[model samples]
Target: MKKIVTLFAALTIITFLSACGGGEENADAEEKKTIRFGATSGPYSDMVTEAIAPLLEEKGYEVTNKEFTDYVQPNKALANGDLDANLFQHKIYLESFAEEHNLDLSEVIIVPTAPMGIYSSEYKDIESVETGSTMGIPNDPTNLARALIILEDEGLVTLKEDVDPLRASLNDIVENPKEIQFVEVEAGQLPRLVDSEDLSMVPGNYALAAEMDLLSALALEDMPDDYRNRVAVKTEDLDAQFAKDIKEVVESEEFEQIIDEKFEGFGKPQWMKEEE
Candidate 1:
């Protein structure tokens, strides 16, 4: 009986030690000053590289970013615990994707988004373009509406009454004074059509990828808030220290200076403009 009691006490002590060690590990993980950010290739990633990451590093964080080619993977990686935060999506997309995939996600901050713009190698301006011009537009549904909205705003086309701009389609055009012929292609490839088509509506990120100046566009979209891109993280981490830090860095004056210098013509979010 004495030997058995001693054996039981030894087992209890070992279990206690193991539990204490595990608690220490969890504490260490929580205390580690590291952040992993994911972004789509191009200006979004460059935003992190040029400003955000450096700012976090200054605050004693070991920051790392992963560039994704497609939109889907970044959210998936964040949900899977592979990424601490991601910055390539807007609140609408993040919400929609999270609902669709049954993943919990939330927006930390809305960044100044590059707006869709009208570019032309032929016409000098929107008014100078000829009638029946074969215009290049984004083939993807997500961006097609944006291109059409820009056209409407430029007084080139008029959508049917009550047409939701977000869901605007070619069939919704009630009047097109320009007699614009549409050519739909991949959004990312629209920049290449500047030399070939009468006018090409290029998404901003793609234009930056192809080295086109945003100001060079004949007109840039008056971007809606929902359309602006944002930094996202797991819903549970929405209030975490990392998310707060990201918000702080973005709201910094230095961040705006960098955006003005490097990412010219990006439409400022309402909050960002309020600061200006």
Candidate 2:
């Protein structure tokens, strides 16, 4: 009788231990369903915190957002798996960065972008700027080309017909009707230089960071459809379940409403509009 009772007690204890272990394993699996995303500080980070993260949480995802101050680090972090994804660059910038770094990154979805614009505190309009005046443009190749295109559109300058617009440079300019002396400044610094420089070409993100109004731009870039900002992930992770969920959430009606309400005139929802 003593042996029988001892054996039964052992069996009961083993079963209880097994059940507790199983519960712990299940909790670990649930915790594994998390996403770590990277983004530049300012509007990109704002969107994720204000809208994207909450929507993801509602869908049972544990989301982590890491903010970056510069452009280069985010992609580097994503490529090394420090970040599962990133949202801070346009398609051209991402392609250029990936090629230079030899990293395999891919765009998941294009988000609304604040179009680049030529801003001036010294002049009310592009036409009012006197000949031989100085204009500030971004020094980075991609944005330098973009700024040059804006100059071409404004008739202040022209570029060689054969040159790719994405690769255009100061040397590519075939004409400078205004004889506008171009000053190369960092893209982020262009906004602050607006008062000193007769005119400055500023990226939409930088403009917003400087608290400048999008509508205040003297001339806005008719941004190419491909130039819109995107959420990027490692090519290998492109089809991962979390990545697919992110793409869906970004393109959902809930995300669109948040953007429309928060972003307002910053930029239109290219993804939503395309779906229509």
Candidate 3:
């Protein structure tokens, strides 16, 4: 009886040790495989949580998504090793942010642009804005210039000779023959001012926040190749596989369907392949 009891105890001990070792191995395997991403609130980030992340998971990747509300934090987090990647900014914003913070950031993939739109509370169309009608645009340099270019493209004003996208401003308007009121307001405040002003050009993010429909705008931002939408990763971790996964996710048809569903014709994902 004593010998049988001793053999059973030994067997139980061996089984427990084997189980512990297996658990450690499984944990090691799981630790070896996870991709982290940071994103801001709203449609851009929503698209990731709803569509992109799941699609990547289907390909055997474990994904970690960090949701943030502010624009500045995600990039900072990526720089500080708090996040592995972010998907909320365009190339121009990323470059400006990196320059301001003196961080090395690299864009892994080009994503969609939430094109700027010109909306009005009073006027039905661009033609209705008569002489001396007031107009409001974002005061930020990049967006202000972008809005001006759209105004110029609509033949509502004329920019200075040889001024490209960067150099556009009220001073560039040489042919404001209509004497339209061009007011510069803070980007976030533009939507609020629309009710008081004749027309306003606000960022798409803010416009969406204000519950405004972008499809009703008189004119929209022209989509360009270098027009500022990209998925950013730390310069050191911008490995080929990371780039491949991001590109595949961004260009996938699943992403396109989400855009169409959520934006409801107000926004669209324009890609270079379609342009080509």
**Per-prediction count of colliding residue pairs?**
0, 0, 2
Quality of model 2 by C-alpha lDDT: 0.88
Model 3 score (lDDT)? 0.79
- How high is each candidate's TM-score? 0.90, 0.83, 0.83
Worst 10 residues of 3 by lDDT: 264-273
lDDT of 2 by residue, 142-232 (tens): 8898898888898888899999988899999989888999899889899978999888999999999999998888999978756788899
Candidate 3 residues 1-276, lDDT tens each?
999999999999999999999999899657536778898887667767777788888878788889899999999999998887888887778998999999999988776657788888798888887889888888888888888888888888889888877757777788987798878878989988788888888777787778788787777777554664578888887774655777787777876677667665333335545643
Candidate 3 residue runs with Cα over 4 Å from true position? 1-29, 265-276
What TM-score would you give candidate 3 relative to the actual structure?
0.83
TM-score of 1: 0.90
* Clashing residue pairs in candidate 2 (N, C-alpha, C atoms within 3 angstroms): none
Candidate 1 lDDT, 61-148, residue by residue in tens: 8889999999999999999999999989876688889999999998998999999899998988887989899889998777899999
Cα lDDT over the full model 1:
0.91
Output the lDDT of residue 84, model 1: 93
Model 1 segments more than 4 A misplaced: 1-26, 29-32
**Deviation from native of the Cα of residue 259 in model 2, angstroms:** 1.5
**Global lDDT of each model?**
0.91, 0.88, 0.79
